[model samples]
Target: MKTLQSTTFKAIADDTRLRVVNLFVTSREPLCVCEIVDALRLPQYQVSKHLTILKNAGLIIVEKDGTWGYHYLNENNPLNKMLFTFLKKYLVGEVFDDDIKRLEMRLLLREEGRCVVGFVDEKDLLIKIKEKKQELLVKE
Candidate 1:
Protein backbone atom coordinates (compact mmCIF):
# COMPACT_ATOMS: atom_id res chain seq x y z
CA MET A 1 0.00 0.00 0.00
CA LYS A 2 2.40 2.58 -1.23
CA THR A 3 -0.52 4.95 -1.55
CA LEU A 4 -1.42 4.51 2.08
CA GLN A 5 2.14 5.04 3.16
CA SER A 6 2.41 8.17 1.09
CA THR A 7 -0.79 9.61 2.47
CA THR A 8 0.41 8.94 6.02
CA PHE A 9 3.60 10.90 5.48
CA LYS A 10 1.70 13.75 3.95
CA ALA A 11 -0.54 13.96 6.95
CA ILE A 12 2.43 14.27 9.31
CA ALA A 13 4.47 16.72 7.29
CA ASP A 14 2.57 19.87 8.17
CA ASP A 15 3.29 21.65 11.45
CA THR A 16 -0.40 21.54 12.23
CA ARG A 17 -0.47 17.86 11.44
CA LEU A 18 2.55 17.23 13.64
CA ARG A 19 0.95 19.15 16.47
CA VAL A 20 -2.24 17.17 16.06
CA VAL A 21 -0.22 13.98 16.14
CA ASN A 22 1.68 15.17 19.18
CA LEU A 23 -1.58 15.96 20.90
CA PHE A 24 -2.77 12.45 20.19
CA VAL A 25 0.51 10.98 21.29
CA THR A 26 0.61 12.62 24.68
CA SER A 27 -3.06 12.81 25.44
CA ARG A 28 -4.25 10.70 28.35
CA GLU A 29 -7.77 10.67 26.90
CA PRO A 30 -9.76 10.32 23.72
CA LEU A 31 -10.83 13.52 21.95
CA CYS A 32 -13.76 14.45 19.75
CA VAL A 33 -13.52 16.45 16.52
CA CYS A 34 -14.94 19.52 18.25
CA GLU A 35 -12.49 19.17 21.09
CA ILE A 36 -9.57 18.91 18.74
CA VAL A 37 -10.72 21.94 16.78
CA ASP A 38 -11.17 24.04 19.87
CA ALA A 39 -7.88 22.90 21.35
CA LEU A 40 -6.00 23.86 18.24
CA ARG A 41 -7.94 27.08 17.80
CA LEU A 42 -8.63 25.98 14.25
CA PRO A 43 -11.85 26.26 12.35
CA GLN A 44 -14.13 23.25 12.71
CA TYR A 45 -14.13 22.51 9.01
CA GLN A 46 -10.34 22.80 8.80
CA VAL A 47 -9.85 20.49 11.73
CA SER A 48 -12.31 17.99 10.32
CA LYS A 49 -10.59 18.15 6.97
CA HIS A 50 -7.22 17.55 8.54
CA LEU A 51 -8.59 14.76 10.68
CA THR A 52 -10.03 13.17 7.59
CA ILE A 53 -6.61 13.30 5.95
CA LEU A 54 -4.95 11.80 9.00
CA LYS A 55 -7.53 9.05 9.12
CA ASN A 56 -7.02 8.30 5.47
CA ALA A 57 -3.30 8.04 6.09
CA GLY A 58 -3.89 5.50 8.84
CA LEU A 59 -2.28 7.77 11.38
CA ILE A 60 -5.51 8.25 13.28
CA ILE A 61 -8.82 6.51 13.81
CA VAL A 62 -12.30 7.67 14.67
CA GLU A 63 -14.46 5.79 17.09
CA LYS A 64 -18.14 6.48 17.03
CA ASP A 65 -19.98 6.31 20.30
CA GLY A 66 -23.51 7.52 19.88
CA THR A 67 -23.26 11.05 18.48
CA TRP A 68 -19.57 11.54 19.32
CA GLY A 69 -16.63 10.91 17.05
CA TYR A 70 -13.51 10.33 19.11
CA HIS A 71 -10.16 10.54 17.39
CA TYR A 72 -7.17 8.57 18.61
CA LEU A 73 -3.74 7.62 17.40
CA ASN A 74 -3.57 4.29 15.57
CA GLU A 75 -0.45 2.58 16.87
CA ASN A 76 -1.08 -0.51 14.78
CA ASN A 77 -0.72 1.50 11.60
CA PRO A 78 2.61 0.75 9.93
CA LEU A 79 3.50 4.39 9.21
CA ASN A 80 2.97 5.47 12.80
CA LYS A 81 5.36 2.81 14.05
CA MET A 82 8.15 4.28 12.02
CA LEU A 83 7.36 7.81 13.22
CA PHE A 84 7.67 6.65 16.81
CA THR A 85 11.03 5.08 16.17
CA PHE A 86 12.29 8.13 14.36
CA LEU A 87 11.05 10.47 17.08
CA LYS A 88 12.65 8.39 19.82
CA LYS A 89 15.95 8.40 18.04
CA TYR A 90 16.13 11.98 16.78
CA LEU A 91 13.42 14.18 18.21
CA VAL A 92 13.15 13.30 21.90
CA GLY A 93 16.17 15.33 22.90
CA GLU A 94 14.93 18.56 21.34
CA VAL A 95 13.45 19.55 24.67
CA PHE A 96 9.98 20.93 24.20
CA ASP A 97 9.29 23.82 26.55
CA ASP A 98 6.93 23.51 29.46
CA ASP A 99 4.46 25.92 27.93
CA ILE A 100 4.25 23.94 24.74
CA LYS A 101 3.83 20.69 26.58
CA ARG A 102 1.26 22.27 28.82
CA LEU A 103 -0.58 23.60 25.84
CA GLU A 104 -0.59 20.13 24.37
CA MET A 105 -1.83 18.68 27.63
CA ARG A 106 -4.50 21.31 27.95
CA LEU A 107 -5.65 20.67 24.41
CA LEU A 108 -5.88 16.98 25.12
CA LEU A 109 -8.08 17.61 28.11
CA ARG A 110 -10.51 19.95 26.40
CA GLU A 111 -13.36 17.52 25.89
CA GLU A 112 -12.85 15.58 29.10
CA GLY A 113 -12.07 12.41 27.18
CA ARG A 114 -9.34 9.79 26.69
CA CYS A 115 -7.17 8.91 23.69
CA VAL A 116 -4.82 6.09 22.75
CA VAL A 117 -1.34 6.73 21.35
CA GLY A 118 -0.49 5.17 18.02
CA PHE A 119 2.93 4.67 16.47
CA VAL A 120 3.72 5.54 12.88
CA ASP A 121 5.47 2.87 10.87
CA GLU A 122 8.49 3.56 8.63
CA LYS A 123 6.88 3.32 5.24
CA ASP A 124 3.96 5.48 6.22
CA LEU A 125 6.20 8.31 7.34
CA LEU A 126 7.74 8.57 3.91
CA ILE A 127 4.43 8.43 2.23
CA LYS A 128 3.08 11.13 4.50
CA ILE A 129 5.97 13.43 3.69
CA LYS A 130 5.45 12.91 0.00
CA GLU A 131 1.78 13.69 0.30
CA LYS A 132 2.49 16.82 2.29
CA LYS A 133 4.86 18.03 -0.38
CA GLN A 134 2.24 17.42 -2.99
CA GLU A 135 -0.22 19.42 -0.96
CA LEU A 136 2.22 22.32 -0.82
CA LEU A 137 2.63 22.09 -4.57
CA VAL A 138 -1.09 22.27 -5.02
CA LYS A 139 -1.31 25.29 -2.76
CA GLU A 140 1.42 27.01 -4.77
Candidate 2:
Protein backbone atom coordinates (compact mmCIF):
# COMPACT_ATOMS: atom_id res chain seq x y z
CA MET A 1 0.00 0.00 0.00
CA LYS A 2 3.04 2.28 0.24
CA THR A 3 3.46 2.61 -3.52
CA LEU A 4 3.07 6.33 -3.37
CA GLN A 5 5.04 8.25 -6.00
CA SER A 6 6.67 10.27 -3.24
CA THR A 7 7.76 7.09 -1.55
CA THR A 8 9.81 5.94 -4.55
CA PHE A 9 11.28 9.40 -5.02
CA LYS A 10 12.32 9.62 -1.38
CA ALA A 11 13.82 6.15 -1.35
CA ILE A 12 15.96 6.88 -4.38
CA ALA A 13 17.01 10.36 -3.29
CA ASP A 14 20.12 9.08 -1.58
CA ASP A 15 23.19 8.59 -3.78
CA THR A 16 23.86 5.20 -2.22
CA ARG A 17 20.32 4.10 -2.97
CA LEU A 18 20.73 5.17 -6.58
CA ARG A 19 23.85 3.03 -6.84
CA VAL A 20 21.92 0.08 -5.38
CA VAL A 21 19.15 0.71 -7.90
CA ASN A 22 21.70 0.84 -10.69
CA LEU A 23 22.91 -2.65 -9.80
CA PHE A 24 19.46 -4.21 -9.96
CA VAL A 25 18.58 -2.08 -12.95
CA THR A 26 21.47 -3.33 -15.07
CA SER A 27 22.11 -6.85 -13.77
CA ARG A 28 21.09 -9.92 -15.84
CA GLU A 29 20.32 -11.98 -12.73
CA PRO A 30 19.13 -11.36 -9.23
CA LEU A 31 22.03 -10.43 -6.92
CA CYS A 32 22.97 -11.65 -3.48
CA VAL A 33 23.25 -9.06 -0.68
CA CYS A 34 26.92 -9.92 -0.37
CA GLU A 35 27.42 -9.07 -4.03
CA ILE A 36 25.77 -5.72 -3.54
CA VAL A 37 27.91 -5.08 -0.49
CA ASP A 38 31.05 -5.92 -2.42
CA ALA A 39 30.06 -3.86 -5.44
CA LEU A 40 29.19 -0.79 -3.43
CA ARG A 41 32.38 -1.21 -1.37
CA LEU A 42 30.32 -0.77 1.75
CA PRO A 43 29.77 -2.78 4.89
CA GLN A 44 27.04 -5.41 4.84
CA TYR A 45 25.02 -3.51 7.42
CA GLN A 46 24.95 -0.33 5.34
CA VAL A 47 23.94 -2.23 2.22
CA SER A 48 21.24 -4.06 4.15
CA LYS A 49 19.99 -0.77 5.55
CA HIS A 50 19.64 0.69 2.09
CA LEU A 51 18.03 -2.46 0.79
CA THR A 52 15.43 -2.22 3.54
CA ILE A 53 14.53 1.28 2.41
CA LEU A 54 14.27 0.22 -1.21
CA LYS A 55 12.09 -2.70 -0.26
CA ASN A 56 9.80 -0.51 1.82
CA ALA A 57 9.49 1.84 -1.15
CA GLY A 58 8.45 -1.14 -3.24
CA LEU A 59 11.11 -0.63 -5.87
CA ILE A 60 12.77 -3.99 -5.30
CA ILE A 61 12.01 -7.46 -4.03
CA VAL A 62 14.03 -10.20 -2.39
CA GLU A 63 13.49 -13.94 -2.71
CA LYS A 64 15.02 -16.32 -0.23
CA ASP A 65 16.66 -19.52 -1.42
CA GLY A 66 18.28 -21.56 1.32
CA THR A 67 20.45 -19.22 3.35
CA TRP A 68 20.76 -16.64 0.58
CA GLY A 69 18.40 -13.95 -0.61
CA TYR A 70 18.47 -12.83 -4.20
CA HIS A 71 17.29 -9.32 -4.89
CA TYR A 72 15.95 -7.80 -8.11
CA LEU A 73 14.07 -4.72 -9.17
CA ASN A 74 10.30 -4.83 -8.93
CA GLU A 75 9.44 -4.79 -12.60
CA ASN A 76 5.93 -5.78 -11.61
CA ASN A 77 5.28 -2.10 -11.02
CA PRO A 78 5.37 0.15 -14.07
CA LEU A 79 6.84 2.96 -12.02
CA ASN A 80 9.65 0.77 -10.77
CA LYS A 81 10.53 -0.27 -14.30
CA MET A 82 10.37 3.34 -15.47
CA LEU A 83 12.70 4.45 -12.70
CA PHE A 84 15.20 1.73 -13.64
CA THR A 85 15.10 2.80 -17.27
CA PHE A 86 16.05 6.29 -16.21
CA LEU A 87 18.89 4.99 -14.03
CA LYS A 88 20.20 2.91 -16.94
CA LYS A 89 20.13 5.88 -19.28
CA TYR A 90 21.25 8.70 -17.01
CA LEU A 91 23.33 7.33 -14.12
CA VAL A 92 26.90 8.14 -15.20
CA GLY A 93 30.39 8.99 -13.84
CA GLU A 94 33.42 7.37 -12.20
CA VAL A 95 31.51 6.24 -9.14
CA PHE A 96 28.89 4.56 -11.25
CA ASP A 97 31.54 3.09 -13.55
CA ASP A 98 33.50 1.66 -10.62
CA ASP A 99 30.37 0.17 -9.13
CA ILE A 100 29.52 -1.63 -12.36
CA LYS A 101 33.10 -2.73 -12.88
CA ARG A 102 33.34 -4.21 -9.41
CA LEU A 103 30.00 -5.93 -9.81
CA GLU A 104 30.76 -7.49 -13.19
CA MET A 105 34.01 -8.71 -11.74
CA ARG A 106 32.44 -10.04 -8.57
CA LEU A 107 29.95 -11.94 -10.71
CA LEU A 108 32.81 -13.99 -12.12
CA LEU A 109 33.07 -15.69 -8.74
CA ARG A 110 29.65 -17.23 -9.19
CA GLU A 111 29.44 -20.97 -9.60
CA GLU A 112 26.72 -22.44 -11.79
CA GLY A 113 24.79 -19.17 -11.82
CA ARG A 114 24.81 -18.86 -8.04
CA CYS A 115 27.03 -16.89 -5.70
CA VAL A 116 29.43 -19.26 -4.03
CA VAL A 117 31.83 -16.83 -2.41
CA GLY A 118 30.33 -14.62 0.25
CA PHE A 119 31.67 -11.37 1.75
CA VAL A 120 35.06 -11.03 0.13
CA ASP A 121 37.28 -8.24 1.41
CA GLU A 122 37.71 -5.28 -0.93
CA LYS A 123 41.43 -5.75 -1.63
CA ASP A 124 41.19 -9.47 -2.29
CA LEU A 125 38.08 -9.01 -4.41
CA LEU A 126 39.86 -6.45 -6.57
CA ILE A 127 42.90 -8.64 -6.99
CA LYS A 128 40.75 -11.60 -7.93
CA ILE A 129 38.82 -9.52 -10.40
CA LYS A 130 42.04 -8.37 -11.99
CA GLU A 131 43.38 -11.88 -12.18
CA LYS A 132 40.12 -13.13 -13.66
CA LYS A 133 40.26 -10.41 -16.26
CA GLN A 134 43.80 -11.37 -17.13
CA GLU A 135 42.79 -15.00 -17.52
CA LEU A 136 39.93 -14.04 -19.82
CA LEU A 137 42.27 -11.86 -21.85
CA VAL A 138 44.82 -14.65 -22.22
CA LYS A 139 42.11 -17.02 -23.43
CA GLU A 140 41.09 -14.55 -26.08
Best by TM-score: 2
Span of 10 residues, lowest total lDDT, candidate 2: 126-135
Inter-residue clash pairs, candidate 2? none
Model 1, position 80, has a per-residue lDDT of: 76
Error of 2 at 91 (Å): 0.8
lDDT of each: 0.60, 0.86
Candidate 1 lDDT by residue in tens digits, 1-140: 46765766777788666656666665534667655654565667887888888888777778997666888777886767777556434433223233235445444322223433222233353564466567768989
The alpha-carbon RMSD values of the candidates against the true structure, listed in the order shown, are: 15.9, 3.3
lDDT of 1: 0.60
Candidate 2 regions off by >4 Å? 1-3, 126-140
Overall local distance difference test of candidate 2: 0.86
Candidate 2 has what TM-score?
Answer: 0.86
